[model samples]
Target: MMVLLISTSIMFSCKEKANVLKESIEADIIIYGGTSAAISAAVEAKRSGKSVIVVSPDKHLGGLTSGGLGWTDTGDKSVIGGLAREFYHRVYKYYNTDEAWQWQPKEEYGNTGQGTPAMDGENRTMWIFEPHVAEKVFEDLVKEDSIRVDRDEWLDRENGVVLEGGNIKSFSTLSGKTYSGKIFLDATYEGDLMAAAGVSYHVGREGKDVYGEEWNGVQTGVLHHKHWFESDISPYVVPGDPSSGLLPRVSAENPGEKHSGDDKIQAYCFRMCMTDHEPNRVPFPKPDGYDPMQYELMARVFDTGRKDWFQKFDAIPNHKTDTNNHGPFSSDNIGMNYDYPEASYERRKEIIKEHEQYQKGLLWFVANDPRVPKDIQLKMQKWGLAKDEFTDNGNWPHQIYVREARRMVGEFVMTENELLKKRKTPNPIGLGSYTMDSHNVQRYIKPDGFVQNEGDIGVETNGPYTISYGSLVPKKNECKNLLVPVCVSSSHIAFGSIRMEPVFMILGQSAAAAAVLAINENTTVQNVDYNKLKEVLVAKGQIVE
Candidate 1:
């Protein structure tokens, strides 16, 4: 009897192990990202009666939206619709509650906003918010929708996507977990999934003639924003000694010809969330390898009597500010992130850490260093990182804003023509109205022997223009079951406008709806009927044209 009992127990244990092996996860749609787009896509899929999962490399959701970028980059509020606008309305609803205001009184935080009213009482939309509030909103969306999110599931880019006859059967992550789906959406900023799937994409600025775009290439001559140095700053380590070599952050290479194309990408910076409220502030700590001489150029710029030091301290709520890069030498670690687009996971982590150290050191220098102007240093001392935010990541934002990355060269390549409304957009999925904005791509030596920042262009679109549905999908031959919304097919200049968080949610919802439509019809994503898709999108309140 004892022998039989032991044998039966062993048998049960083996069966349990087998059951665990058999319990692999599967979904109708698999969204690979944790950006705002990923959440929208998952919610839309659930609403359409399809099971979806969000497998992301990031631990947090909502990307930059929940990161430090609380001040919205919205161009036209009317163009935002569907799940995108719904999100803002939810933000409005959250703030409406008495408990939502923690650090400040609701009445005190009056009706100040950007171009439009931030606290819109009529339409019920709130554009600007705190970072933690945005994150909570995203978390509420996932919980309310009952969406499954697998965080920190890094995609095995080398050999993970198992494609069967141009269709992704499944993809594995570095964690040895595999997710299977009928339809897939690559909602990542870097377009990692699309790149891994062998989809065609462009990394840097395309030549002007490639897409017949005026702002597509090396824009050395154009100076749109006040980001460039107003007066020429010497690039030498010693004031005028070229033999002393270039100073830190100043590249010695020649900036390419004006309007010529190159592989350089725009500068990226952390949109810092700082507060003067001492109770909720963490003083900036000196980072390892702190070098005060690195910012010599900025010190010189300040010495030139430019007192607009606090120009871009865009305010949010609760005495906090969305501090962005402003002036010639500010928060933007320019020309240091060239390898981030195609970098490996480990390499990318290193880059992110490097940025974090640089920014932290900069803040420390501005507040405490004797080299900084006395007036500016005194003012900066009052501001520090919000202690209530990003508790898991040391009060710093988890995600850096990847302004531009690998853009899928899908069926329709959105250029300035489409943005400027020179050509009609076909099968409209969403609308984008933000200016064709691009930050300085490279800070290099000019021909006249002075340091200058290049590739900052800002040209307003004629009006709200439709984003093509074709831009979301890979070429019909490349992959039929995949949709890329965040990294949609667009030129470098065009993406600067479409890369907004709200626009991403709009396209993400559209992509999810299309995926469901394709699944229902037993057809490929490319073969889904546009008329049928439009009907569903309109019903869902998408701004489809």
Candidate 2:
């Protein structure tokens, strides 16, 4: 009888352990992402007297900001406020100290930025910085707030999100860890959580008629930036021989009609942080699949006597650069990454690996290939990957420049009309003043049979324009307790302006504030009082105007 009782007690204890393991992690707010917006949202939520947890796929905290996009894209600096501005102030404080400038003197690194001073002493903000500095800042922000973050946790897109009466009850990661929250924030660049939650979203470019705006769809002729080929370059492998087939990286498909939409997204590339400081530089490693023929198109571009190869090696601090895609055949891996937005995690990893290989091979080809111009080759050989950046990722940027991705079709769709000041934005939550920029989408054979790049649009906005609060929340019927800050509800052209990192941080804080207000009032995110939200935002140092 005693032996039978011991067996029963052991069975009950095992059952209790299983039940405890199955219990979900509960919080007042849950944020999914590790971007700048995610960190800002988590911090703001914690400050609002709510328990918040950040489930991050990335091991590192800040997305592109710390991942080598050190050169901040600030259109109008005064419009930036709240925690976003505070972040820059923190950067300023770090740079103000003598120890911050290790490799270069403070006086040597001039205050040159995008039409403004990089380090604004009057405003106490530093726009340009190094990768490690930005990461430290983000880490400190969350650490000070005591917010919980679970790193390297990927969302199970297939069956992760659980909805009960149009509200997200909980979501599970691939590791079988579930989190239940009163409100959720999808701060990812790809909008994985939003899409998994059955929220409405558009993947690629939309027709001009869909948004009633120019520069929305397939722009075959409208090349704004210097990314297009200047001189005529043949797409054929054997120069002008059509039967020789097309060279690599050149698409053969029809680039669609102008102003008409098809499923195509802008190119993606790694914003490499390179340095000429020999002691702190690691020579660019040749990728495993080093194919010189892959960059034959670039060789042709260099053959055209184009010497502006170093135009976009923008300097940040300590002799390091936020090297971006510059010329026609530079870093932007055109005609790729179309299906990356909605692809599965495994497929996305493959895509990211391909991008990394392509970029690394491009660097090798430019530096070592005999086909490249001697001047450009010699200059490229001088620069190498910064040894201090992305230590775990082989000195490469941890985050890829996912310029555009799945955009949610939510309560209000901001179009170029709003950015151009033709239509006024209502219920302003933040401000964006950057140009409506889109990178080259396709590199295809023109109708005349010459190689030309398409879908690079760069239309300037009408100064600082207000971003609507409705853009962050989904429609009333789709989901009730979710807000998206990174992939907000905006048309392609409008999102081009709103997708800036600082603006993302601004929207993140606003979204968290709205989430807290909704939780307190026992209401949906769509039902949050705009007046109360705006008041709270203003009180918290957010520039609503």
Candidate 3:
């Protein structure tokens, strides 16, 4: 009797373990992210006749696209194709309706974009749109395809991924839900899944020598944008007194050698979706721990007769604006997010909150502070947060503009040479033509004890350059079944151009197609035939030139 009872207990224990490991949801492809790339990948996977699941960390769909980055950074609209171009076409269709324009009429919203018409009638595509409209388009894309999206499902980065023979077998989330798949795609901006999978990746800037690129690393005394302190402003709390202590936001450390390597990355900021319309404007709330002293440097910048505060308030539909970091001291919180790429989730939240507080405080200071120039203050006061956008998050964007992060060091690493037309890209999958841009990395005191900004680059590419297929796959030895579209394999300078949302969508579609081909051939993503992949890409409206 005792032996029989012990046997029963052992049997039950083994059964429970099996149940725990069993995947709650299984599919042909499992995508980890909620960004625009994730949506595009999921849609493509479904269109390819495969079961797909998106384990999204965010409740929302689009990352920065629907997160206040309405002003598209499209370099050459002609090169954008596949689902990416489809997205813009959907936007154009939405705006063609009478009800789409709520706060303003379609005629009043002029066809102004970044050197192109906002609504390109000939191509039936719209580049510029409001945040809510972008989100709706993303939501519709998923809904139309009937894609399974598990929202707010945070990946258990510590012990989630289960790999077998260089392939991911399954991964669990914080909710204890196991997801099994034939192939995996990491579409997050931070490359969380890629890093968690133990694939090789690099954070921050690589030295110019690392990739033989001119704009890869630390760039002191080289200011391409207007985001530098043109005037001689002292870094000290009290002007010309080093003993008085450094002012807030100004770094005390040594700005590294020019063109040398450093761990610093470009500054990040909330692309504030603001509106001057009285009916739909919500005043910028004073953040929880608002401090006026933080804006003293900004006030000093204004004192220098710089009236370009509203320079980057790029217009969108509905009388709204996609306000980005402009002048010397604006939205880009300089020198505050070095550890964000690899920080713990809790720590990242803290950092994001700090950025939010800093930006909100900056807006409040500009609108109400006595030190601000009366002319600028009056103009700023007219603008406020769009009442209808991001209503769940206090009318502030949920996604931060994480311009660059963990770039994978995979089988092929794109360099400035490829973008500059010096070296030809192999196994082209998509195209990118945006300027090799990087926001200011650090703000430090110059050799003469004056304040200055560093690491703001804006070198235009030769033209539309092809993106290599290898840039999306890992070295076969590292991870065979995993595909990374967002944090692609490229040098920092090259990633500057590839990090655009349209390119991400393009890569996402290409990655999904590659994943399906790999599954069909029973081979690794690295082993998928380039010719077969290119055929599918072109057939699916992807311009791979």
- Candidate 1 residue-wise lDDT at 16: 66
Query: Could you give candidate 3's per-residue lDDT for residues 1-545 as a string of tens digits?
Result: 00101111122463463323323678899999999999999999999999999999999999999999999999998999999999999999999999998999888988899878999999999999999999999999999999888899989999999889999998889876778889999999999989888999999889988989998898887889999999999888899999999889999999998888888889999989999999999998988889998988998998889889989999999989999999789999999999999999999999899999999999999999998999989998999999999999999999999998899999999999999999989999999999999999999988899999999999999789999999999998999999999999999889999999999999999999999999999999999999999999999999999
Instruction: Look at candidate 3 and give me any clashing residue pairs.
Output: none
- By summed lDDT, the worst window of 10 consecutive residues in model 1 runs over 1-10
Q: Rate the local accuracy (lDDT) of all candidates.
A: 0.89, 0.91, 0.92
Worst 10 residues of 3 by lDDT: 1-10
Q: What is candidate 2's CA lDDT for residue 344?
A: 85
Clashes of 3: 0
Q: After superposition, how far is residue 499 of candidate 3 from its true place, in Å?
A: 0.5
Clashing pairs in 1: none
- Selected candidate, larger TM-score, 1 vs 2: 2
Q: Against the true structure, what is each candidate's TM-score?
A: 0.95, 0.96, 0.96
What range of 10 consecutive residues in model 2 has the weakest lDDT sum?
1-10
